[model samples]
Target: MSTTKWSIDTAHSEIGFKVKHMMFTNVSGNFEKFDASIETEGDDFTSAKFDFSGEIASINTGNADRDNHLRSGDFFDAEQFPTLTFKSTSFEKESESDYKLTGDLTLHGVTKSVKLDVEFGGLAKDPWGNTKTGLSATGKINRKDWGLNWNSALETGGVLVGEEVKLNIELQFIQQ
Candidate 1:
């Protein structure tokens, strides 16, 4: 197998996250617009090239007010940053189905190395005769590390938002 180029099927993909809110429950959200391109030597993903970009203003949490707040400087500050991006640094195959993917994630003017556990979901051909593949990546990072430090102090006890932000990505790619 040679180096194959793949384009993300954004319609069938998702970039989402979850964070602790108010100290008790989790607030789940997804980015509505994102783009990714992948290059792999045949079916071997152990070493590949991956690049991803997500529009910060397209965040959806099902609440208009909160969504707007997220777009403000208190959070992503979409006007200034516009987008969050990731460029792969390395991929290490650990087991038959597990891979540790390390990448440079840039958000809010901060770039940091992040690791994700990627699970190759196999491949298949669609009715349209297109070769497709599935992948899922999950990771976590401290929000404050990226300069997204704005938060409120609850009068009762703890803070309003937690530091850890959990990331979950489900992607489908079609060979192009």
Candidate 2:
């Protein structure tokens, strides 16, 4: 197989995350707008490249107040840092279906190296005769490292929010 460029079908993909809120409950949300591009040849994945960029202002958690807070300086500061981005730096194959993807993640002016567990979801031709591919990835990062450390103390001795945030991404790409 020859290497080909694929554009992410954002309408069919999702970027989501979860964090511990109020010391015990979990708060989850998804970004409504984002873009990604991928290049790969066959299943070897040795020559693959991946890039993703997301709009911070598209965050929606079902509550306007919470969403506003997330976009404020105390958290993501969407006004100043309007975008979050990631670009693959390396990839290590662990199995036929699994891989470790290392990349630089930038958030709120902070950039850090992060690793994600990637699962190849195989490929197929859609009803429209378009070749499509699917992938799912997951990872965790400390929000404080990204300068998002805003929280309050709880009477139970824990902070209002957890420092670690879990990211989940499900993407579908079509040959372009």
Candidate 3:
């Protein structure tokens, strides 16, 4: 089998997330700087190996003050941790266009196994002639799982920030 390498088309991809705030509303955020790579044997996604990293300093939640707080020691501690990463342990195809991806996610110096649901978007050739593929992945994780334990108790009986964080990733990769 021949090995195939793929590089992320950053311009067409996004690493985004959402979290419940005050037990009522959802706050969304995204990483402005990140990279990912994938390798497979002869275009077979089931044999894929994935690696990804997102810069903590590049986090954006629309509000600068909130973004800064997320980068502070109370949260990501961007100056110390700098980045969050993931390395896939398994890529199992559950159907023609669905997959189960299990990986080790490292954030704030803590590592844990996580699972994500992936939907294949098929392959296509861009206008520039680059062969590309797209994938959408979703999952949920507890911020405290990675040492992001800073929070406040709301006077109304709920916490300021919810424990669960929802992940929504859209990725496009070009064959290399």
Highest lDDT: give the candidate number. 3
How do the predictions measure up, each by TM-score?
0.97, 0.95, 0.99
Q: Report the number of clashing residue pairs per model.
A: 0, 0, 0
Q: Write the per-residue lDDT of candidate 1 for residues 30-141, one digit (tens) a residue.
A: 9999999999999778788999999999999999999999999899999999999999999888888788989999999999999999998878999999999999999999
Return the lDDT, model 3, position 72: 97
Ranking by TM-score: 3, 1, 2
Better of 1 and 2 by lDDT: 1
- Taking the tens digit of each residue's C-alpha lDDT, what string does model 3 give over 1-176? 99999999999999999999999999999999999999999788997999999999999999999999999999999999999999999999999999999999999999999999999988899999988999999999999999899999999898999999999999999999
Lowest lDDT 10-residue stretch of candidate 1? 40-49
Model 3 alpha-carbon miss at residue 126, Å: 1.2
Question: Which parts of model 3 have CA positions greater than 4 angstroms off?
Answer: none
State the TM-score for model 1.
Answer: 0.97
Runs in model 2 with CA error above 4 Å? 42-44
| Cα error, candidate 1, residue 52 (Å) | 0.1
Residue 150, model 2: Cα distance from true site in angstroms: 0.7
